[model samples]
Target: MNNRILVTYASRAGSTAGVAEAIGKTLIGKGLQVDVLPMQDVKDLSPYRAVVAGSAIRGQKWLPEAMQFLSDHRSELSRKPFAAFMVCITLSMTNAGQYLEGLKSWMSPVRDLVHPVSEGYFAGALDFSKLPFSLNVLAMRFVVLIGVWKQGDHRDWSAIHAWAESLPSRLLQ
Candidate 1:
């Protein structure tokens, strides 16, 4: 169908998945048919006219599974209208211009395989209980000792909805 789209994401601690669902809902509100699924669960792209892929960032990179999903579906994705989004703690620390410039490095690998018509960057949430104890300890050191991070939901929904509102034009045109 001309209006069909796929919104998929790879999430580590669930923030990215919530973002994907919100995106899918927004697309549906725009009268497009959409499916929001975990990246690993999407086996085919033929049913969708456009694909929106997203991921949670870790260690300055898109999670491995999200990268793998793009690589695995590169052929089909390169032929279709593909867009991407990323959720990261880094966004909370930068200005718009700086964030855009810096995140380019993170997308370099994806850019090599797919050119997204649009890209969305949103702040992500943090929950130590969702992470492994080792990582929890490390993150806590950064949070507690350095006073570098605060643990809480940091996603900007207004920004997210605004970005999603702009996508149909970019994806369906």
Candidate 2:
């Protein structure tokens, strides 16, 4: 059967968009027809066999548009093979507990809204330079005090690819 997968995300500074694109590429490589789109552009989910939705977490919550998209399509999503991920600096490669919590929080809404076949948390990048001045100052202080805000890409590409590849297998069953 031909599988149509929709990968949607709400990104603030492109990290989440990158993750969504990577997932779409991986699914395409696996022979699925994938549509990678922003949450605002996805008004319906009836065309897809499976859906992968994600968003960057801000203040420990999904972006409003992403949340609304899920809320609007909850029923359709529940009937399909679904997966989710969250982009957050809280999931830096070195912090296991924070990563777990970020993943849990990211997936919590998905779990409550749909029965996802798989879910993952990928380490997110935080560029202090790209942040607004207020956020940058806070991040700088955070880096200085707690050493949590390193300035570079920390995404785990291998893990993301693996996670994306595994989705089809889980959903096919």
Candidate 3:
């Protein structure tokens, strides 16, 4: 039987969706049958042998849709070889270690709920222009004052690819 993997994500302004696509491409490159879909579009997880669920963190929490996806599929997910990933601006290059720690804490609840075989923390993009007006203004000001926020996509594509390529080996064992 062919091994199929579902790659699903929850994105607010498309950055996380880009991450999901990159992951899907990497998995496909490894000869795995993969489906990349949005969390809202995926109603069931029964068709795939493994799953990789990703979310964009907002205010230190998993996006509502993603959290619900996990809660809704907890039982099915528990039976498979699964992985979880989160994308966030907090993971920008300069503060990667700190951001990873925060991501770990934020994911703890869902991690316990799903008990995945592997998990990942990916750096995400921050386009102030795409953010809500109030948030954009605040983020801009914070960047100016703190001197840490650099505009442009900050995702580490290589790291994402490496993680995706390793999943099949991890799950099939």
Candidate 4:
């Protein structure tokens, strides 16, 4: 059986990439073949048996490039098993009720194109240094208003690993 899985991601400040890498590593440890790459670098899905795509949440949506990738490959993605994950600081910090509502808005667009068998939402790192002055000020205000703790990397590796461990069965079917 084909167990080759593509773990592709689009990250802004590198948090989603880290999660993708963790998922890929965990899948490999479970005796599956995995390839982790940025979405733009993935040339073909033919070599992959299944795909796990993720992106960093920006402005309440997946990055444009990530959405475009899904749009470009919607047919192929729908024909095979596909999974998606997102990394956002505010998303992970919100309560369960708000999380589901926020997830619907964030994941709705992608779901319209492809149906993912599995989905993940994770807290990503926040690096204000990467933002310009104007955006930085706005981000700070958003953080303060949201009542988030000190800004920094907040990813949960164990949760990521657990999610990865559960994928082989879903992906390989």
Candidate 5:
């Protein structure tokens, strides 16, 4: 059997999951066998030749399960072609470059642990209805008060697709 490419992700409010799916579809279009699964569902890495992992950012960190997945498979990951991505509403804010700089600081725990051949930073969606009951109140009120955040989908599909298009060659080579 051909070694498949694994695309695993952790999502909250669903934006990151959509991004992961898009990555999986793009890879499939490139004629590579792929499997996209939630990070928690993946138990082994031996069947895959490459990996792409991502998570939604909350309080500036990858979700616990996503981080744990990487830590658990660090050895296997180090030997394979790997890539990572992140979804964050902060990326839609002004001064995105600075936001990314701060995001890097937040992602230190993961970076210090494993290195990916490439990394993607994409804007995320924000739907007040999807946020937890408590956060919904806070986020809605915060948006109304600060006028800094708007509720809508902000993912850049062109960028996401472009990034994914670059992966097969890099990984398969």
Candidate 6:
């Protein structure tokens, strides 16, 4: 039997975790065994045949733990099929083309560091209420005062599902 697929993520405020769960569930529906875990919770890559890793973006970079995971498991990961996704509100539906262009630039570190078979870019969810209390209040006030931050769920479920469903064959190819 093929080894299980691992859908691991590094999320702050949980949006990326939700995306990882959706991916894991879609793979399971296709009769693949899957393990969905946080990057911190993953201790072994030996059990997985392929990996789908993602992280929420802050400023313009992936979380430290996600980067560390890739760094720590570089050799093991290089031997298997891998795919990556990034979650950022800036990549909203309205700006998907820029998202594609930005994907290569933003993921340069990953590309330079490790090879992946495919990549995904997704719009992220952001709720000011979920941020730390002081930061939330500050961000809410900033939004009201300057209209810089957009707060809402912008993730496109159908797109995420379609991408997830394509992975098994993608790995094969």
Clashes (backbone N, CA, C under 3 Å), per candidate, total 0, 0, 0, 0, 0, 0
The digit string of per-residue lDDT tens for model 6 on 39-90 reads: 9999999888899999998757888889999999999899889999999877
The better-scoring model by TM-score among 1 and 6 is 1
Off by over 4 Å in 1: 94-97, 135-144
Reference-based TM-score of each model: 0.92, 0.87, 0.90, 0.89, 0.90, 0.89
lDDT of 2 by residue, 1-173 (tens): 35788899999878899999998899889988899999989887888888888888876778888888888988888888888888877667475664585358557766787777787787787776676678745855676367656667878888889999998888766
**Model 6 TM-score, 2 decimals:** 0.89
Cα-lDDT of candidate 1 = 0.88
lDDT of 5: 0.87
Q: Tens-digit lDDT track for model 1 on 7-117? A: 999998899999999999999998989999998899999999999999998877898999999999999999999999999876775454576787878888878889999
CA lDDT for candidate 6:
0.86
Clashing pairs in 1: none
Compared with the true structure, what per-residue lDDT tens digits does model 5 show for residues 52-153? 999998767888888989999999899998898989888887777776776777667878888888888999998877877787458555864687766789
Q: Write the per-residue lDDT of candidate 4 for residues 29-72, one digit (tens) a residue.
A: 99988999999998778888899999998777999999999999
Report model 2's TM-score to 2 decimal places.
0.87
CA RMSD of all predictions: 1.8, 2.4, 2.1, 2.2, 2.0, 2.3
Candidate No. with top lDDT: 1
Q: Give the 10-residue window scoring lowest on summed lDDT in candidate 2.
A: 93-102
Q: Quantify all predictions' global Cα lDDT against the true fold.
A: 0.88, 0.80, 0.86, 0.87, 0.87, 0.86
Show where candidate 4 strays beyond 4 Å.
Answer: 94-98, 132-137, 140-142, 145-149
Judge candidate 5 at residue 58 and give its lDDT.
74
Runs of candidate 2 exceeding 4 Å displacement: 97-103, 133-145
